[model samples]
Target: MFTIPSPTIVNTSSRPLSETTIVRRKTRPVRVGHVTIGGGHPVVVQSMINEDTLDVEGSVAAIIRLHKIGCEIVRVTVPSLAHAKALSEIKQKLVETYLAVPLAADVHHNGMKIALEVAKYVEKVRINPGLYVFEKPKPNRTEYTHAEFDDIGEKIRETLEPLVVSLRDQGKAMRIGVNHGSLAERMLFTYGDTPEGMVESALEFIRICESLDFRNLVISLKASRVPVMLTAYRLMVQRMNELGMDYPLHLGVTEAGDGEYGRIKSTAGIGTLLADGIGDTIRVSLTEAPEKEIPVCYSILQALGLRKTMVEYVACPSCGRTLFNLEEVLHKVREATKHLTGLDIAVMGCIVNGPGEMADADYGYVGKQPGYISLYRGKEEIKKVPESQGVEELINLIKADDRWVDP
Candidate 1:
């Protein structure tokens, strides 16, 4: 039987009250192919391809494209038995052409057979609990009796047991993904269209999986509205704490539209939970190309100091006291040093804020005088150079310290 570990407690009375790091919630590690989620792993980034799984070559190409660009896991929708069968080809072609990218199959709307089929090919299987044993709504029915609820619950267990057993035996993972919009009819009637319903919906599925001794599970409670998404995940965590369940959570905001607002909405929901140390894996569902979502995922993780994938640039918003064209110089500095991962570079417009503001940066390019720029290694001003040669001087400084790599 699986047991949840006790949550870690730290004493900070002797130290500062504030912490600069995010303390992630304790969760058991659930491996999905070569990658592991939770158990103090770096938060994993994932995105789904929109291609039809029936087109095996197209799907293989799409998965490779996403995996090459740092999407740790790629999900493909398996709507029908045929699509589920096509994953066999997709997995084989990936191994033959590129590499064995960790793949997940999104199975929904009475997807027992589909899930079982695709589970043979993919590392993980994601199911919408509300749709897994889909209960179509009765427009006239207002409420469900306790017996009726338990009766349908039994049916869900019967249908889910095979998949759980299959995954448990195969050493694969399952995601109990609950969407606020798609709560089962019984859940909607029992708890209404709220976060409570979403949590309960996931809990029902979770209990069934646990009953079968299948514990390699990840959970997600996602909603398009930030408040609903946030509240549902929080409630789920509370319940899990009480129940001694330590399943890792997969965080996302489903159908977060496209473009700027989509990114903001995704960040608002995913970022908030991550700040509170809530998620183990994340997906930013944008209506744009799947490739566009990877950068946003890394940016969120980078901004939170959870992961460092690119140079961290610290630039001040220019003011009248500025000594150079701040925006232009910042751009030039970025272009020259963007490839330097794991380094913090600061661009400050004036000496007033330059040294102090960029004290923690690995390197700094600051406005020293009208026609010159100050170069810094940490807080010390190394030299002043002509504005035209500032970027070159920064590169020279980095090379001097043996940190420059050819890009």
Candidate 2:
């Protein structure tokens, strides 16, 4: 027999409510190989390969692993001409094996030559606007005069013209990625080390790309600080709307160190922009390996109802009213159901917040008395079982409902 706690049932739905829906910003799509950014496409998840670009075999192995785990785009550094040339071989090997994963080259310093060389090999070239045109800020110089700034812009155009032409002709894309720590001196003098500075830094290159009639561009405004990252992206969106430029945005929080701290920082920055519908592609930067970053990306996207990959687990913090070994039971429950994708499973320690807390979850396991557990398929109690029997019963319930998927 089923035991229903008074007021246990709460409103639960499989889909998010209408009022909380995120309306993605409208922008023209930019194609990076086979993946599409903006234009109402799902936000793409991408990661950079830290392996040496010269290690074609190592890089290919890493890419294959990342591809299996659902990384849509992959980027590698092309700091030298050799690395740039290596990209062609990498692409060739990937094609020979039918990987077809879109590759991007992150170029700086000697970007123009590397970009030009890698343009035909990779789908996109990412250049940091701050480092592309100007040398690192020297201690002697404070700011650039108006004419000096114009000359700098002109020089940038001169350097970029050939590569821009090559990329345009080759049907390639560019990412003017601007970072908080690397703003050019002129921008710093004008706007200080703020979001305005980062936006201006990127806008300068964006205007350059536009003048050359190259529209296949994506932009990023990244900072290690979550607040700064969020502010920069918000400011960039407003500026893009003002300029009537709907270029796709790449979102990330740079140097977000590893483990829980990294995940929290990345989520706060990238997740906020995603929630506001302001990002086209996202990378969850962690100190860990690149392949480890993919699941976190999917997790953030899934929580926002933007994308789905694995099961969503909701477990309440244990409290005085708890009636079971929640940690052990929860682990057991997850181990059994981790492969279930797109389902919300709630493991509540006690009735206090069980039903209400699990209102958004599709299935719920709530602790009742010392050894008892109540199972719910969306609020209504389906059965009562002992603590020892709960996990198996949950699986049985799922199978009975025909919601079981082989792991």
Candidate 3:
């Protein structure tokens, strides 16, 4: 319900129904298995399997379930040497079953061994720049001098060099995923624990990879705070542009808790960036089951008109003028025609709010009286029917017009 003005947006739609159209940022493509991200490819939807990585069967099943529901990329945590070794089995099982989904190893805290061991088995490996090779910051910390800072950077490079070389040799990719909650001590000292610090943490690792002449890299700047999340990603894009580094970006709001708040926060943060054309891949980090995250991802993409995966419903908030059971009727309509995608259906409460109100809707259903319903096709009044028969009439209308498809 809150609205703010943005002047940089260009008129994207010929009709201008929404605010400015989002022009996607152009970046070099990074291959993660069979999926192509960036370089004008469609934004990829990804999710992390919550099962333990060592539990090969559980993890493999999770990935299969995710793939069935449209997840394009998947990540599994590799916290131990065993977990790192398990990635080979997981990838082997996926291959054996003819599932081509890419596996990414998420490694943190002195992950050199795991990273090196897992790199060749999976399509990509994700290292948290904050914890990949740095000591965790404490409440009481010693400030390092300039010389010490350089020494630390060199130490990090030494730690990561082997893994980077392995990834390069294997033709695999790396995601320099930096979370706002876990900023490195060096960054905290130099830039403070802020969005700037988050960007710097990622850049440090990215610079290391580039120094090695490794270009198969992706980047992410994630935070639970919407403003911080958005700010960090935007800064990353600007900095990448300035440095002429076009590595693909992965967007998310970390620790976005379960249910409606989680969905809203994820959407606000991810959607804003997607609207600005910044993200190359996205993962909605809900505390709920990971499979539940897929539909929400597709819904956000569909709402922005960036992708179409299902039917779009545009119903009004019913007022006292509402003549019938608006929610009941709308639900029935959705249930009946959920398979007809890329079409906008509006279920309005009254005529005064129908035709013009749902102007963007491809089809409209409006209450004409206490027991009567009116229908329209893109603002043209199509017919009226009894309220009791309204749901069936709407389906019949859609079928009559060749819009119905069996699910």
Candidate number achieving the greatest lDDT relative to the actual structure:
1
Model 3 lDDT-worst window of ten: 1-10
Candidate 3: residue pairs that collide: none
Segments in model 1 whose C-alpha atoms lie over 4 Å from true places: 1-17
lDDT ranking from best to worst?
Answer: 1, 2, 3
lDDT (10s digit) by residue, model 1, range 103-153: 999999999999999999999999998899978778788678889999999
lDDT of 3 at 58: 91
| Local distance difference test values of all predictions, in order | 0.91, 0.87, 0.86
Can you give the lDDT of residue 48 in candidate 2? Answer: 90
Number of the candidate with higher lDDT, 2 or 3: 2
Best prediction by TM-score: 1
lDDT per residue as tens, model 2, 1-56 = 12222222222122255658877878889999999998999999999989999999
lDDT (Cα, tens digit) per residue for candidate 3, span 1-407: 12222213232212334656667888899988889889989999999899998898998999999999899999899999999999889889988985868888899999898888888798999999888886755666567678878988899999999998988888889999999899877777777667878888888889999989898999999998999888788778777777988888899999999999999999999998888777889999999899999999999998888888888898988889988788888889888888777888999998878888799888888998888999888889888988888888888888898988888
